[model samples]
Target: MTTFQKVNRYKKIIQDYINKHPEKNSDDVLKHLLLRHIPLNKDSEQSLQALSKFRTTINPFFRELVKTLKNPEKNIIEVLDIYLKANPIKKNDDFFALLVAYFNSFEDLYTNKDLQNNTALYQQVIVPLHLYRERMEKDKVDLACELLERRPVLKYEDRDLNAINFMSPDYRRISSEYYENQRIKDSVRKDHRLACEMIRTMAIPKKELGRVITDLLKKIDSDDSLVYLIFETLGSLPIPKDQQSIVVTKLLEKVQNSKNRSDSEAAVKALIKIPIPKQQGEQVAGILLENIYSGTYDFRSLVPKLASIEGQLERVVTHAIETASKSKPSSRIFDNSPEYTTHRLACESLKILAGLPILTESLRERAVDVFLILAGYSDQQMYRPALEAFREMTIPESRHEKVVNKLLENVDSKDGIYCSYSCQALAVPTVFEGYHEKIINKLMEKIRDPNGKNIIYFCVALASMPLLEHQHDEVSNRLFELVDTKNSDDFGYTVQQAFRALLKMADSNEEYEKVAAKILEKLDSGDYRVKCSVCNVLRGAVLPERFHVRVVTKLLELIDGKDYTVMNNVCETLGKFPIPTSLVEQVVSKLLPCVDITSGHHSIDKCACEALGNISIPEHQHEVVFNKLYDRIDTFKGSFPQSVKPDACEAIGKINFNALQCPVIFYKLFMRVMNPDNVFETLNRDNMILNTLSALYNKMTPTERINIVARLESMQDDVASKQPNRLPFLLSVIQKCQSINAFSAGLLSHLPAEKAEDVRSGMVR
Candidate 1:
């Protein structure tokens, strides 16, 4: 028949099948027809034309099939057998592609007993695979490797099969006379390569394979390439722990002696796979230290591997500190001195060692001495590393007192950087816990010292302390006394710092109430700066219950005060507290007039929006709050300035739409933000819209969610075309909603693979 006639004939057959099975989609029917017909005329014009028509007529079924077959239950040999039987191509290229597809579908079958017992089926697969490899095509060799490396269910009785023989070359070379004769003819490196590949590919009995691998290791000598291959092979094997220790010992020796960095790194990599016994840790640490000092490899790469070896942490730390101490500071100005290089390496290594979770007291003390020496260096570069190292070290409880004393000595040092670092180190909660009362007394004394220049440092240290509820009254009383008596001209900022600490330390309602009363007293201060600072403190210390009401009343009273700074701070703090349901209307009424963005003071308007957003009420008030926020957004959309729009958007996003069951609000917000003209320019505004949609998603019904996904998909093309950068954000929104429903998840499976992956990873983050 003519080519056109044949193409027409095949198309009719496909169409008839699709018509008969309406439940089966057009794409599925097209896949079945192509699989049946392509192999018969793979290289013919008729088949090529038919393939082109089919491609245009259906979705990409082959890609979907590949993904489906990756699932373990669907990747069975029976499924592959059906496909192979239907698509019987003759051309080698087409046939190899089919074979690869089949091999890739072979899921891990190591524990499939029924398949293991089916000897007949094993023979059927083995004979054809062996013949295909014997053809010796370059691609076929790779295909053979891919198939043989899989965990096969074949038994030892199948050793006679050529496919099995191909995978067992190392075993045959060591244990069989014929293979040994063949190996003698090959180059030494080639033989080693073959043996390593064999070990990697074959599932030989453990006892026999272990003996062969040991013998091979013994034969490996000065050849770095062979040693690298051998170590890599050993890493993949499931050797027993005792055997692993022996392997680690041998690899560590190689790591120390090998001049080649790659070889040493490979040996280290192998050692990491094997567990070193606690007793061997010191020896292992010694060898690693020697390699590190050799300076042949990047020492940073070695630190993590050394850290992974449990036990002997003390030995490693001590060795690292000693090596770092030997690195003298450079004397020359612009020369690349060995001393500088060594010092830098030492500092880096010390930082890593000190950061390790396990540390002995002696090792920590030695590390502290090294850090102090580095910290004392005049150059900021030298001291910054020391500060970082000290910060990471968890000073033991026993050493906290000693460390605190050492830090206190530095607190009065001439160098401001050193004093700052010392104060920061002492600020850590655990370090401060041991000396809380003494530190508080010392800070109070320093704050009271008329000539004391370190009051700021003292106030900061006090703020950093983890004041317990039991100590709250004592600490608050002392700090409050400073605030009450300190002159606003001399120590106003210091007093603010004291109030900051007091606010953080206060825990109970009564404690917060006392703080509130003091704050109210400060609000009446003549100095606007004092009132403003008090307002900032109040933002963080908004009390619960009746105290909240009282605090709100005080903040509201100050909002209309004459000073703009005081009014701004008061409005900002008022917005932060969650106004109760009874007070929502009153609070909203007061804040609404402040929402006028055209008024020169945008801060007041911003704070008003923020406060209104934070107003807490029953579900019944959702529409009220949403409409007020939305009206502000609509009013500002085109005509108003851009700065105020985000405040309005954020305020709208923060409203409790879920409680109000206001899906339509979310839908409208999404459509507005996703408008093609608006999406790219307002990418920063997408977060608020996404959060709104996410809240709506949880409250949506199944059918409603499906409709949402459909709408998103419909607009996806426009989004990609106009705002390609927002595609990931768009997909993330859909994925978050669809992930809860399997039906929606399947519907979204057609999204680009990378985009889908980005969606998943974004959700995980």
Candidate 2:
């Protein structure tokens, strides 16, 4: 027979089977055809080709199959089992899309056992599902909406069924009128109401949302629970502009007059969320100002909202200055005194006011006046916030003279702590530039005094101040002299700060080498404690690249030292330095043995792992380095603690493996991290690996990234069931598959509503 005739015959046979079993969908019919008809026809290839040619005839069947998967009459696992048996039918993109849609239909709230008892079926589908992740990611919104319309809640077992929640006073009335009529109880109606609300909110169209917003607002005066839920719902929806005022009015009433503090807090929170018009920003600011001293609103939340408008911010600062003026400065703070309360409030208010981006000259002067008054009060706790505020002020160069005078006077305070705090505040470059000489002269005078105190703060403040090329030598020579005066226990910190001060002066390659040589000289001549302090300084330093080898060479010698604190400090400091090409062998050789389980030092081992990660290993060294690190991962050896494994995984992941090596490295990481026996450890280790993979992802070639993603996708089940909290992190890494943010926005915009709500809560929680 001709090929056309044969194709026609096969179509007829499949049609007869579908006609006979009217209940069977495309997947079922395909299975029947494969199991029963293909053998009788004895032309598997011909039948398969005919099916592909007449695929359009079966297009409706595929759509019907997706619908069935959405609200399956039978167990979804059993349903998919039949689908998986028909491998030929699974070849098309539609089947893969249907699989992804079906999987996402289940909520993250479902327990692993509730999801799929049939591991075989899940494994079969996950492979192809992952293969089509890119395609589904593009259509994620449409797919979620489609699935929601048919089967709003996907995984609902009898275990989830519970009596209607009558805990809320409104529950019985609402359930009797709404849920009772709909008969949603056989499903997880009571238990998953939030899930229902989330899906309902997501599925609602923009045009329809106005009415929902209005209805939710009308009920804001109900019980506090319902009021919070309504306000939360309002925050998520884009309320109409006309209704925005209604929202603000309702929330304002709650803020000023709600019986419960939580309700007032919630109202203030909701007000912060709704965008106020630029023209009306001052009006909102005025309303908030009216309630500022009412002891009802959270000023911290109100600050950002008011700060959005320049006029509002100025008004806020003006009000803050007025409030500060009400409290008289006293010799000491008292808990019960009204003056103390007012002063405390003023101090807190000034700190918040100081953080604003813009402060008018008059407001700055008044605010500084309040700060100076607060400084004289004997409360040490109150001084730093006020002084820090003084430091943070955005004073133009023309206006800094008075501020410089006040700070300098404080620097000369006989109260040592107060002097140190003032010195700490002078570290701002903008304020310190022209006034460095006056401050330097005062600090030098204090340092030279026999009774001087807080020398460490003086050294730190001097180091942090931006210095010109001509000032470097003078400061370095003074710090070096201080380092030479360090035999006494009281001068140890002074000596360390001196070393830090000298290193901070090195901005040029020659200067850096000079500093490095001086540090080595100290390391060689200094005691164990001095060596430890030097290592600590280098750990936080920006690190000098030109003289990295000399520093690295010195650090390597200290790595194997008997002092635990010094060894760990040395390893951490070494991690901060990029390995110079000439010393890669020397550095790696010295550090590798430190990570060995036999090293007997836990902290040092972890730091060694970090040090290994910080360097760039050549391609030729990838195997030895990867193998050594991989052996430290838990799955390879039981003795390695969870603490060490994550760092080891991090160490291995940071290496730039060749394409041929990417899959192997990822596979090892996946196996090590997917341990179902211990979910907590799995999550922590997975987080470490995924973070490293994400950082390494962009550096890899397109082909290498694709391979890595495919390998990661293959373990989707292990991720979904084993360590689900890490799902967001995994998706984030996978999202790098698409470069543009618009595509990411779509993914977020479609994230199973409740998931999106959780993400929002996580931000503030």
Candidate 3:
């Protein structure tokens, strides 16, 4: 069959099950249904369709499938993944059984005796052998060998070792055990599988693993593998609690004798994980730092993890960074990850340790040279890293204010934006105060410098401008000029953002008028998104007497527009207020048409429901919205995406508190909101529904608030601790209780002393 017809035939089979079973998640059933089709080409739409179809489903089965299959020579994994993804429970009964069924019928081949040879079926068939080997029994393996007609040997050293992907910690040990039992030498034989297996074995038992690795480290030639193994083992294994000094001793020996670059790095890393007593560990760390200090060991990959170590790691990290400054960054330790991210994380870590004294004058000079060398690297986050580390190492803002002032003096064009970012980072409000003028001047020049050719520089430069502002006019003038830019390419988003920054600095009408005018002008702009953007900005603006008339005129006009999104933003923004009786009906009419129609876009739908929340005053419109949400509740069986359903609850959250006649419906809607649905598969996406959920809970009574919190707490055992949001819900309860207690306390304080005492005593009684 053609790939298309064959896939359609399989999809039909899955869909028929969905129609028949209905109980299985739509995604899982579909995966099992689609397993017959395979060799999905990258260019083929089959992958896209399958992903798109199943992305709607909410199970970890697909991720497991991806993990199950990633082999160099295999297509059956994809088929098996889909089958199990569609039928996890069915397949979970026995992965071996599932695999046996999958390979047992190679339909068209039809060689009865070829199938009879269990060895050929298990080994040559290519699908079930590896996965089954990981989990299967000795008896099952014999049966598999009988059917396939070849021994299914999964141990790397015993088979085509080069073909195997790197195994896990368990599988790695398995390979190592197999090799040792056969009396094979890893060095002369060159078995990658055995090497990987040994590496993984080290992760679980560091002292024992460290001892074995010391032997292997003597012979290992590949620095990369040795280093990673050493790093992983150190990173994962616990140091022997009773004999910590032994681990330190082994690591010191490993780093001293280690010829491979990564092996040396691993030895360094493993040393950090060892629990040397503070005074003793400090001495041991000093020794490791001396080796790195002496320029004996090389570190390429373990630098970050090394930098991340506590106690003596600082000495090691500082020494290595210092060493890198002298030696050319031998493509060994040069990392290309985001500079600011690495810098920020490292600084935070250093900051937590009293301070970073390692960044002294000699260190600073070397760091500067390293930054200059690294400037040519392609990754943008690099410069920020250096600046942050420099920021830490440089004397504290209190001690080195003069140094920053001196640096600010060199703010000329010679040093460039990299220097400028570094200087500004050093001079931040907490860091430097007197150099604000020089810093701002440099920022404006960089921001306006068309040839400066740096977007991130300008973006960060502008974002940082308001951080420590003494003068407002120059800042406002600079911001205003950008806002009124006639250039079409100047998408108002950035400048509008700068205006928000300005709002944070502004206090009076004069400041508000200039800011509000810029925002209003954008709202009236021809671009649809700009208009929506304008509404969002204006909604957040302070409603002063001067700006209110202008903002209201455009807002009312926006409410009358056909772009549903703009209208939604307008009505939603307006709903936050006490609606004038006259405009209440107009807003209601604007929202009525959106009542139960699933908005093609979520934002427009959000705006519509938010606006409706103010006044569902019209009777029929109220019934339409309530019933529409009521009917749609069951539309998503188990795997419904919560975004669509969250809105339904949000719309109810608003209407429930407003003038809706159905208190019973509101109560039921609140209960449904409290229930955990499969639609909310992941909590990573911020659903506006939580905003609605919180708002609905707030509008509720003490009993209702308790009801919501109680329901939220029940999901804790089932949901991943990181995934479910318990903090916000718990805070809301505490906040409500505090407010109520404070008000009661204030009222009781007003009574006569005797009566107050009696009241207090009565409470105790």
lDDT of each: 0.59, 0.60, 0.47
Q: 574 in model 3: Cα distance from truth in Å?
A: 6.0
Each candidate structure's TM-score, on Cα atoms with residue i matched to residue i, is 0.48, 0.60, 0.40
RMSD for all candidates, in order, please: 18.5, 14.1, 22.9
Query: Ranking under lDDT, best-scoring first?
Result: 2, 1, 3
Residue 334 in model 2: lDDT: 47
Q: State which candidate, 1 or 3, has the greater lDDT.
A: 1
RMSD of 1: 18.5
Cα lDDT tens digits for candidate 1, 210-329: 565565466556445567777877777776666666777788778877777777877877766666777787788777776575555567767756766667666566677887776555
lDDT of 1: 0.59
RMSD of candidate 3 to true structure, Å: 22.9
Ten-residue stretch with the least lDDT total in model 1: 102-111
What's model 3's TM-score? 0.40
